[model samples]
Target: MSRLLHAELTKFRTVRGLVLGTVATAALIVGLGLFVAANSVSVCSKGTVDVECPTPPAGPGGESVRDKFYFVHKPLPGDGTITVRVTSMTGIITYPPPNHDTIVPGLVPWAKAGIIAKRGTTEGSGYVALMTTAEHGVRLQHDFVHDVAGLPGAVSTGAPRWLRLTRVGGTLTGEESADGVTWTRVGTATLTGPVEIGLFVTSPSDLTVHNGVGGGTAQARLSTTTATFDNLGLTGAVPGGGWLRDDVGADPEPDGPVHHPGSAEESAGVWTVSGNGDIAPLAGEGPGTQMTLLGLVIGLIVVIVVAVQFITAELRLGLVGVTALTAPGRARILLAKAAVLGAAMFAAGTAAAAFVVPVAERVLHANGSRRPFLPVPDVVTLSLTVGLLTAGVALLALGLGALVRRSLPAAGLAVAVVVLPYLAAVVGGLPAGASQWLLRVTPAAAFAVQQTEPAYAHVIANYVPMAGYFPLPAWGGLAVLAGYATLTLVLAGVRLRRADL
Candidate 1:
């Protein structure tokens, strides 16, 4: 077996064209990665002058987040509790779908109105809120990423919801009640020091989805929500001043009003609060590791061709027969060939991915791409993922070559099953569901392992393949591709044992 392996390695080395092809493939990976970074430019303007966009704030978990809402708050020096009964929630969707001409009274699913005990009035501060959502019922959210579901219903005048948030030392507890009598603890968060306790309201942009040439498109229109809160109660040490109103994250307009402004008012022991924008983890597209790894798609095609030809070249030259006679164990010979090819591709792929990722990231930032709010995969993880992906594709190609006993057909089959499906899902005109289906079932699913952005149910956006989301988890998708490769190799082994050489 060792001799057979050595002999196969020798054959691979002696072929100058094949060796050069591998080198060229690695070069292509790096070249295309840098090219993508170079071309990805984000430009912002203020009036007629160009301006650099401000970096987004980091949440408690260091993930990028959107923290904008209307707060009617008072400073509490220490431990405190704030409670409010939310009687009604209403919103307007501007220029919705179909005609896109008029604003309608409605609410986007994530519209939230609640009582919060935050570290301060600052955006992105650690806070916990027991809130009622437009569609998701009662929820307990903290720090941006963490969310827990509470009761299951919307708020109305007849069916009001009671929300309470309390802080004792470092622990914060959230509770909700339908009748303000029996309180159900929703969740807890850890935050200490002085905080601002208040009533707050916020709504995300109204998304209008449309099917288009490339899967679909989502247009975000400005939207706002108003919440009517009565029976407001507070506990613990508080300042003597009246409630302060601040529209966190809202920019001042030319006319001095808040841009996409939020409002706060008190009348006869009742508070009406209205706000625009979201107070959650940032969703949708951002600069991702995928930007650096774009070259892998083209590089994978080059690898498929090289891997297919590795075996097919031997078959074409009538050398496989001579080698089979010497080895006697046909399956062992095929396995040995696969091991050699897979190892070589793995090394090249890992090196290329590792080198390009950081380099491309610097380039991307220089070109004004937004810093990724999602967790970026580390260099080692990215390298190993790409390495494993390359090895899997190479083995599959080799198996197909062995089964078909021809070069072009086997290479074509490998690319059709893997590369085409990937390209189609990411860039083709297929519907979002169809794109997700392809990524789930096809060998192209392995590409999901490269994905850095994950879908969050709490943050609604286009979770489509084109928007850098996959239906399957990263390793799960890789397993799908690995399963196909393993099965194909098994069949090829069976064929090699029975077929005429």
Candidate 2:
């Protein structure tokens, strides 16, 4: 067994394709590492905040502070009044609403509106303020619930119970509780410098007018209720953890001039950036970014090409018969060859991935926007998954090659196995029953391993409509692909054992 393993390894190294594949893999991994390291911002100095820390580069918004940290400010529930005041180093009160008619007076122009209002019949309103000598812009937003359905005939039950302010380097989270002792985390905002923050409120639901009328209908009147805020407090920035900050200036204003429409920067925050800007283009169209359907097409082509090379080159040269005679056991020779082919296919597939992924990313970045790319785990897992699937599919091709002892029919069958189900899925769509289960057995199922989005799960689930169809969980999708691979290899093994190759 050791000798066979050593021989197998030797064969792999001697193969020119295998050697090139290994080099390609190493180059990709190193290139990605360097790219990330060059682009990442270093936050921690001496394991703590450096009071004399040098200013970071201008962020997307051309702001000096490029990140933000947040801490929570808890306000009590129910109808109440609260006033928060912020005083700057220059004696300017930067923390309040812009004016009395507005929510508060003298608050930072860009600061987000942070308030924790209760649901039910009451109404709430508040304002926050910040002061900075540095030309910094603030953004205020109401943190609302996501993805929850409201009751029938009721307006959206979603309420902003938390507030988050974000800047380049820091963040703050505020939660309101009935008793301030125990507070729920409502939301958090990031900040970059020393700024005064305050919470202030006015008005309850009682004063709200429905459509500017006293005798408005009940449905219209429901919009009149508002909650007043009270008991505003401020806490110092917490250590280490902070809000994810982006280049505020780089972000396009909703009504502002258009820059790079649908650029890569727009997609930056969607994933976590790694060491630097080395990104993978999993979402775009390229050889690497081609849809799963395309991958299936490519995989089929690979199997046919390998099968043709194996059958014609070795059989026409009479090597198969000689090897079978020397081994006496046809099964052992076939198994040895299968093992060699599997290793070669795996190395080739991995090499192809390494070669294609980085180039694809660069192309996408160039065509789109410039932003940091998120890191995916090393190619080890991706390589293994693809290798296993390819090996299984290859074995079936090898078996067909042996059974037909001809290149043309085997290639045609291999292509059909990969192409037919995809064609069926496209034309008929995955039917709502056992037919969908049949779809999973196709090569497309294996490609689901490459998906990086949760939404793709829904797409895949809908693609295959079965009675018990829930889109396979990430791991489940991989397993389904593996199961198909295993079945193909098993059938190939059975054929190899019986056939007189």
Candidate of highest TM-score:
1
Best by lDDT: 1
Per-residue lDDT, model 1, residue 320, is: 75
User: lDDT at 60 for candidate 1?
Assistant: 78
Report the C-alpha lDDT of model 2 over 129-224, residue by residue, as the tens digit.
221111121212221111111111111113213222322334443333323344343344333334333232111111111221211211100001
lDDT of 1 at 339: 87
lDDT of 1 by residue, 144-214 (tens): 88889997999999999998888888888999988889999998988788888899999999886665666
Those runs of model 2 whose alpha carbons end farther than 4 Å from true positions after fitting are 1-296, 308-321, 369-380, 403-406, 419-439, 456-478, 499-501
Evaluate all candidate structures by whole-model CA lDDT and list the values in order.
Answer: 0.85, 0.36
